[model samples]
Target: MRPLKRLVEQFLESEAKGGILLFVTALAAFVLSNSPWAQAYFDLRDVYLKLQVGDWVLKKTLLHFVNDFLMALFFLLVGLELKREILQGELKNPRQAGLAVAAALGGMVTPALIYTAFNYGGEGAAGWGVPMATDIAFALGVLSLLGKRVPLSLKVFLTALAIVDDLGAVLVIALFYTSQLNVTALLVAALVFGFALLLGALRVRSLTVYMLVGLVLWYYVLLSGVHATIAGVLLAFAIPIGRARPLPPHADGVAEDPELHEAQLELLEDAAREAQSPLHRLEHLLHPYVAYFIMPVFAFFNAGVALEGAQVGSIALGIFFGLLLGKPLGILLFSYLAVRLGIARLPSGVGWGAIAGVGLVAGVGFTMALFIAGLAFDAALLDEAKLGVLSASVTAAVLGSLLLWKTAAPRPS
Candidate 1:
């Protein structure tokens, strides 16, 4: 219980801080895009920035490298979180998982349907997946602002729902957003993946070994026309989940030998403790890397969308309605139906008000939506998707925060 409480506290704090950073980054992007130096702001990406050495060199447009390479680390952290949750978190339990899975499916399907309704049989039809995302950071941040008023069960539900939402986004990218497959590159990627699995089977524990091989996998996947970020997800599955040792029972306050136990009890207790196990240490070591470095860098790169003139046209309308309406509609409707039909029960200590508030918060789809939009189209339609994403995300954030905050007071016991 102590560890669980600490985990929740840390998660909330990190998410709240990330939200503040995101707000500043987005505001800067909007101002820079609309300012007198707009061209310079845009052209900042085109300027050459490289590391030149005798035998090694690296060069890329400022934004291109940030968006592609830096974002991969973000995806890598995401992949790790997904893997951890599937193994040991709320997702590890079937009944606990079912509600979130159903709600996420409803959230995704309804939004796509809504977006399709707006852009069906039109040039911008492929943009339907744009609104089917829920940014976990923003949602968690909103919940954090509500403090102890919001129940722990509600936070868990939101996290579970977002995890499932991410799974859906991964599928959408793999199925619909991919381009012409490059068989040769894909074959190379497969071989690299095979090598990673081979290392895992050999019980390689060093991250450096995986990192070296992962870079090759990342390159091959990038060239394979499958979204490069998916490589991060695939690679995370190969990482080992072995723990170092099990906690031993304390020998204190109990007779060791019954005949002559009191004298030896302290020694037995000292020998039995295994609190600083290898696996526990590893989890602690990795947690900081995932929380601080990977996520913040991802936000800095991906969240900086050039918000120039707001596109309040068909695209923006489609995005806003899809998220604000679709997320809650899907979450509440499917959740209620599941409970009513006896498919799943509402989690203990959570009320409809908390669940509904979380559903609203789940509509804020900043990171994943932007990533999908990039995959769904090139520069031409990219702006339209971005417009939709920005509008819908802002609307979701504002309304979701309000609803959740408003409902955080004393509820029917």
Candidate 2:
């Protein structure tokens, strides 16, 4: 249990660092997009890259590769984290998970409703999912800024809530953002997924075998038009969760065998340490690359919105209100109701004001919002949505920081 707690602490620290880097890269992208080098930056993103295997060829812009392939890796990491939490981390306890789950659901539903209210029956209606996300990196980064003012429990609550929010966004992408499905490709993907499951059931602990099969599954899912990132999630569930076997009790004649008992206990401890599964190993290995490189690159490629002709009318307004107003309103409302109805309770030292502040922070929906907007809007309206996302994210971060700063307790003397 101590080891697990330490692991969680390490994970949060890493996430905080990565969140700061994400902000820097995003800021840089915004600046570069508005500078004299804007055209060159755009051109670089638009450059086509092709992959060939004999006569078979696939081509896409550099931006497409970043979004489709690299972002799949990002989602894969997310899936692994989700799996870990469900099996061993925060979500493993229903009492602890209830608040985060309720908050995430409300967070997603409210933003969609708000956006849909503004764009109902209009061309921008499909973009309702755009504001449903909470950028975990940005949100955590902001909380980290407050230092000891905010309670550790509040930080953990926010982190867990954001993760649940991410899961919701992934589901929306898989369900709504997909193109017309190709049955043949989907069947192939299903077969591969079943095989992967079979291997896991057989306790096959080889990472290479799982990865090879996962790549094939990803290819099929991509061809199936189901938003290839779903493949990442599927692959994650196939990873085995290994644990050390419990030792049998000592024989009756061994009543005085203290040395043997101690040695057995040591062996058990070592075995348990080694029992960590492939899921943990992969998550540990890939977190830095995903956080430091893939996400920053994704932001650089996707966050460069040209503001010259950008409009702030219906689509933009919907997005702004959905994030700024809808997010906090929903999170606070649902959380309050949950507590009132005995469904969930706030963490110790977390008050209504702090929850409100965290909800506002959750409104920093940059990366996922941008990804969904790209899928949901046409080129003409993409910039409008991007403008809204950028503005709302900045506004949320500032407002949330100020609110938390004012409401949070001072550091211990």
Candidate 3:
């Protein structure tokens, strides 16, 4: 429980900053798009930037690099979190993960169905997956602002659900969003993957080896027409799980200290104190990168969507209802049905109100939704989709915050 509390604290702190950046960038994009400099703002995103140092040269639009390369790192961090949780956190146990899994599935499916219902068999049907994601940083950020009013169980539920939501979003992107595949590039990607797997099996401890191979994998995947971010997830699985356990020079199985006799207990304590286990060290090293760099950069890049002079019609209404209403209903109903059918149990200290509020929070799909929207449509409908996402996400964020804030009794210091 102590470890869980600490994790929550760390998650909240980082999420607060990341969420603010997301909101600010989004707002800036909207304002700039609507302002007199709208045409220039649009052009600037497409303006090519190039860097050359002798034979080494790199070129891409600012948006392309940010969306393609930087976002891959973001997905990498997400993959790490998912892996950690499945290995040692709340998701390790099937029973413990049941409620969250059910809720997340419910949240995702319901919004998608609602979206599909509105845009069925039309150009908008491709956008069904847009509302299926839950932005963890923003949702957690809103919860954090409410302080101790929200219960710890609610927070835990939201985190687990969001992780599941992320998994679903990734799958949707890979399966539904992809177009024609480049078989040659895919073959190369497979070869690179095999090398990564071999390194993992050999328990290689050097990150440099992984980094170089990961870059190759990313390039191959990018060309293969599969989203490059998928490479991040694949590479995360390949990271070697080894610990650095330093052994001291032993003298004929005797303790180095004259005062301490040759005792097994003494040796064990020394080993424990000196050895920084592989999992422990990797987690420590990855934590700061995930919390600070990967998440913030992703937010800064992906959160930007032009919001000025947007239509407020069926699209906006549909999105708003799907997130704020449909999400909670779908999540709660499916979860309830699952429990009633004897498939799962409600988490301890978690009630209807909490679950409902979490469902609403899960509706806040600002980041992932926009990314999927970009893939679902060409330039024509992109603006409308962006408008729908922005309005729905804003609505979900505010409603979820208010709902959870009301439920959380002030905890005494």
Candidate 2 C-alpha lDDT tens digits along 114-197: 999999999998999999999988898898888888887788888889889999999999999999999999999999999999
What lDDT is reached at residue 54 by model 3?
100
Tens-place lDDT per residue, model 3, 1-413, is 67467866676677766776667766776776777877787787787888798997778887787777877877776776677778777787786677778888889898888887788777667888888888887888777778777776677777888888898999999999987999999999999999998988887767768878889999899899999888987887787544556656552266557666657557765675446433344456665665566555555454445655455655555566777777888889988987887767766666777777778877788878888888887776777777787777888788888887766554455
Best by TM-score: 2
Q: TM-score for model 3?
A: 0.85
Candidate numbers, best TM-score first, in rank order: 2, 1, 3
lDDT of 1 by residue, 366-410 (tens): 878878777776776677777777777777778877887777554
Total backbone collisions for each predicted model: 0, 0, 2
Quote each prediction's TM-score: 0.86, 0.92, 0.85
Q: Clash pairs of candidate 1?
A: none
Which segments of model 2 are wrong by more than 4 Å? 244-273, 410-413
Query: Which candidate number would show the highest lDDT if scored against the true structure?
Result: 2
In model 3, state the lDDT of residue 11. Answer: 65
User: In model 1, how large is the Cα lDDT of residue 412?
Assistant: 68
